[model samples]
Target chain A: MTDCKLCSLEEYLKLIEHEEITYAQPHKPAIPGHVLMIPKQHVAIIEQIPDEEFGKMMVQANKVSMALFESLQAQGTNIIIQNGISAGQKDPHVCVHVIPRREEDGLNFLWVPKTLNEEEMSTIELRIKENLTVQLKPKEVEPPKPEKVTDDYLLKQLHRIP
Target chain B: MADMSPEQVEELKEKLKNMSPEELREFQKKQCIFCHIVAGRAQAKKVYEDEHCIGILDINPANPGHVLLLPKEHYAIMPQIPDKEIMHLGITAKKLSHALLRALHADGTNIFIANGVVAGQKAQHFMIHIIPRKEHDEVGIDIPEKLLSKQQLQQVKQHILPSIAKSLGARLQEQPVAVEQVSPKEQSAVPAPRHEPREVVIEDTPRKAQPKAPKKEHPKKDQTKDEDVTLDDIADLLGGS
Candidate 1:
């Protein structure tokens, strides 16, 4: 079995408890009020995450945003998540970046397009479509089921009053 | 603000029916009902809502399912809003698109945002238009020619590169792993494919091929017309040319 960094969903949730490792909470010693929202399941990309989980993630992200707004006195908040290497995802783990923004803070998020021509665009689109289509198809053979873990324990550990 | 009473809503509708375009524009300027809806001061049949924005039906719609996605906060143009806001807006728009697809049974939807005066932004308030389209419906909007020549496009790429690089550098400094660095070499190396014109052949039902035949030519002397018959002669004959 491949040793995936994000092996269990509960373990991943626990990682967020330590603000240093998870970076999903406000008041990290180094970066001020950086929050991350990730799926409880091992999903590589936003598209792969189930719709229900995606909705839950958004709600959590909103909560983080509200927290950041209140604590940091942030003018605005930026929610970003990179999926693959091409999209700047350094880690294989899927996570969202909730960075607080302030006026003239000099944080720029302009996408400098390397001007893809029609063919390159088509090729890239086709490649993405192929990968997504494969992922979307229902598996004929069921993979080994993950061990059932109680959500109460995970929730109690993850949620903290700050 | 409280919800309008039935009588009040009826009166409002009556007023709307009587009002001219100028009056409507003035009304919109003074206090936009849509803005009031976003601010939670007015009631609207909201299609979708998130923390940042809300999608509502266009009362006088171009189509049945036409909806406008307006930000809670007022921003005149796309550039004024940060990329994060744009991303959030996009996500919200995507959700709305899905809902519209399911509810309206639409074939597809056109998602467009008009920015600034040149982009045909009628209202001073910024909004995104999500027009739900049905098959064979006459939504007669012409697509304008916004294509740039290859040379012009290259020039634009050249012009924005410095600023893009600077911004990327600054962003990296702030959040080290925030952005993916894409090199120009990798970008330029990929070539676009060209499409060739296709030859179309149409089959006809049992048409007979005709054989060519020689034709006799008329004498050149007989073909010549008399130059003496002028417009004056026609006038003399029938008082007409």
Candidate 2:
């Protein structure tokens, strides 16, 4: 097994680096304006990423997509996340691919939609409903305040500790 | 309306162009079938629902448990969404991905968003497609490798880097002074200092060592010129005939 390239992140061209996420251009990109929003920490999959971290990535992705549209004059953009191995995830690290799309770009994300019977659809729906717990909400963006300890307060705390 | 004459399409496009943003949104909501589905006015097999988002099984699913997670409020594209709402939708997508894995026993999932008609965005309302995947399913979304020359990559970087920085900088300026002060890490990592071209080829050797990457299905279609899809096509999608 090889080391995760995203974790090192030394080689990739860095674009916008936030605390939780690093937006960069892939070394060997699928397209010219293709960029990736990757978590700073080594998170293996989307399910394992913290909600706040994932949220930050998505927000950055939107910003990047907007930039692609305005700056590159890209006609469209695709935000794609291949979550696990079976979904064509080349890297173990969770990275969101933001590709700038032009007309005749030769990249097609369109899939042949398969028609499922009523029974299958209903069964899958029931199963998904049973497993899904959808109460997860993004918490209000409040930066944690570190308590300021004055010199006098530290001295008093030291006396109390003794 | 898909069969509307080009002249009629032109007329509708003109009509859409004249409307205000608020009016455009209202018109979009009226035209969008997904908005109706989100509002519970139309029928869908909903798998999950909360205050901000709803998840329903895709009628013509790529896979068995394919889910379309949509925001309750109608938005035309991902960029139109506010930061808070986009976050909510993303977290919801993660949860739905988990649910698909747990319920369908699927091997993987793909979280997909197409922002314009050119990008395969069929509906006016923005939604996230969470397609459950298995081995050899043939829902080929494998991005073909199209490596850019170094100069081309640099040009792309030059174009995109400032745009992102400007957008983020504007947001940061609007934030509280304390919030901006806290992220010295972000301040240090801004794009200006990193403009020097570093050795990119050195890192290529390590990535090349990993040959165990899964074989992707390259569903080669005869490449067709689709430059006909214009912003008017987006307006047509928003009109939702």
Clash counts per candidate, in order, are 1, 0
Every model's TM-score: 0.35, 0.73
Runs of candidate 2 with Cα error greater than 4 angstroms are A133-162, B3-14, B170-241
lDDT of 2 by residue, B48-118 (tens): 88888888888888888989999989988898899999988888888888888888899999999999999
Model 2 — interface RMS deviation? 5.5
Clashing pairs in 2: none
List where candidate 1 sits over 4 angstroms from the true fold.
A1-162, B1-30, B140-149, B163-241
DockQ of each: 0.02, 0.34
Error of 2 at B163 (Å): 1.1
True lDDT of residue A141, candidate 2: 92
Instruction: Using TM-score, give the best candidate's number.
Output: 2
